[model samples]
Target: MKRTTLAIALAVLAWTAWDTGADPIRLGRGIPWLLDFVRRMLPPDLRVLPAALVGALKTVEIALLGTAMAAALALPLGFLSARNVASPAVFHPARVALNFFRSIDTLVYALVFVAAVGLGPFPGVLAVVAYTTTSLAKLYSEAIEGIDRGPVDAITATGATRLQILRYGVLPQVLPLFLSYVLYRLETNIRAATILGFVGAGGIGFYLQTYLRMIDYRAASTVLLVTVVMVMVVDAVSSRLRARLI
Candidate 1:
């Protein structure tokens, strides 16, 4: 077994090296450029407090409203997409639709929404809704698929309809997990919302782009710092809450 494992490892290493054409000396020469880039990001500015705070608040609002809308829509779609509730023939189309939505990133979605809606926070919210629906639907469907079958079987054996089995047997087991996924998606949407502003969808990224264009590194640094702090706080809270749910 040990020899077989070592042989497999060596084969993988050889294949990777050949496929990527990786060279140790070339990588060594690139290290200094990477270090220089890192060194240039030091000593963030603190002077643009007012603008940063306002931008941060806008970002939070966009995330909150977008997430709420996604949760509302996704809850119903999730049920329809789950195999336990819908037969394979019925759920397959829903799965395909969800996958199609999820395949596009939020940035790309923002661009499309901006074109249709003519830009603003509305576009950002729509982008979030689109991406979050895809994500939550996929997650909730998987949760439903993994549920214990005994309760559903028992419910059906009692002459309950498929919808009744889902309502009584499946939803209870998956609600906490679904909620946890929503919170996680909310945290992700907050970060995406910041970038949506770059496309004129409205958020801190709009101000960040403005400062960058004007060569105001100090103001840009303040924006970056505040955004980092907000993301950290959100991630921490979501992590704690998800831990409790799990």
Candidate 2:
């Protein structure tokens, strides 16, 4: 069975590569042009440093605010969706709603909000909030459901109210995981916010798109570098915090 499965997977991969016109010969031919393009991006014109930094800051702000808003909204939704916390009636519907939210791409949300709210970082924030809420809520629900039932049973045995039980039992067990997930999502949202800016949702992506359109690879490279640095810093910090929490 394993051999058959592996053969099937390889066949599908080959078919996909062929269908997509991923010719190795074509790739080899493009190497020179690719190298030339890379050469053009060398020494990334630092003249755009100030503007790129500002955009990087704006991207961070959008992600932070959006993640905060999503956490606020997702917490209650998560509790409601958790099988151990909410009734089956509530759980099923809430899960369905989360599924619906997860189905739509974040870029689609950004575009829709840009139309609704007009162009700015606000639309990016809204898009991130919508996308992150669904994602975080689903993750939080799973965390809540997977927690140790020992404390939960003890609390329930004490005749504690549902809210009290959640506070005393559930929150303690899941808060670390919740924070880890939020931090991870924040990292993801930063990248997403940058992309959303291409659609005028407002972020470093605006500058990136502008520079690219004008064939200013130097300026575009600066923005890309700033984005990479910002994401790396956040990831490092979040990783440390998660380690401590766990």
Candidate 3:
């Protein structure tokens, strides 16, 4: 049975690869052109540095504000979605709503908000907020539900109110994991916000797209460099903060 299953898996993989036009020959033919393209992006034009800085900063701002807003909104809603805290009636509906939020792509949200707001970081931030809220809400609910029930039970035995049980018992246990999840999402959102500009939602992506359209590879390379550095720094900092938190 295992051998048959393995054969089926291999056959499916081969079929999928063939169907997708995953041609190794075509890829081999493109190597030199890829090298030439990289050559064209050489030396990273410093002239675009100031503009790149501004765009990168804007991207960071969008991600930061969006993540913060999402975290705030998700906090209370998370309790409503938790199986332990809320009744099955509320839990199912809340889970469905969060699932709805998660089902849509981040870019879709950005595009919709961009159309509504007429383009800018505002739309990008809104997109981030919308995407992140459901994501974090779901994670937060799972964390809440998975927490040690002993603390809750102990608190309840002392005649603690629901609010008191949550505050004194639940929050303390889940706070670290919740904060860690938020930071991880913050890292992801920042990277995503950079490309939000591709749709004019705002960020370094605007400048990157502009350079690409002009075929000004050096300028594009500069933007790429700035983006890479910004992402690396943010990731490092967030990782450290999360390590301490969790």
Q: Estimate each model's TM-score.
A: 0.82, 0.95, 0.97
- Superposed model 1: Cα runs more than 4 Å off: 1-45, 158-161
Off by over 4 Å in 3: none
TM-score of model 1 vs. true structure:
0.82
lDDT of 3 by residue, 1-246 (tens): 999999999999999999999999999999999999999999899999999999999999999999999999999889999999999999999999999989987789999998998889999999999999999999999999999999899998999998999999899999999999999999999899999999999999999999999999999999999999999999999999998986
lDDT of 1 by residue, 72-136 (tens): 88877887898867878879999999999899998899999999988678898888888888888
Backbone N/Cα/C clashes per model: 0, 0, 0
Find the candidate with the highest TM-score and give its number: 3
User: Which ranking of candidates, highest TM-score first?
Assistant: 3, 2, 1
The TM-score of candidate 2 is 0.95
- Model 2: per-residue lDDT, tens digit, 54-110? 998999999999999998899999999999899999999999999998999789999
Residue 211 CA displacement from its true place in model 3, Å: 0.3
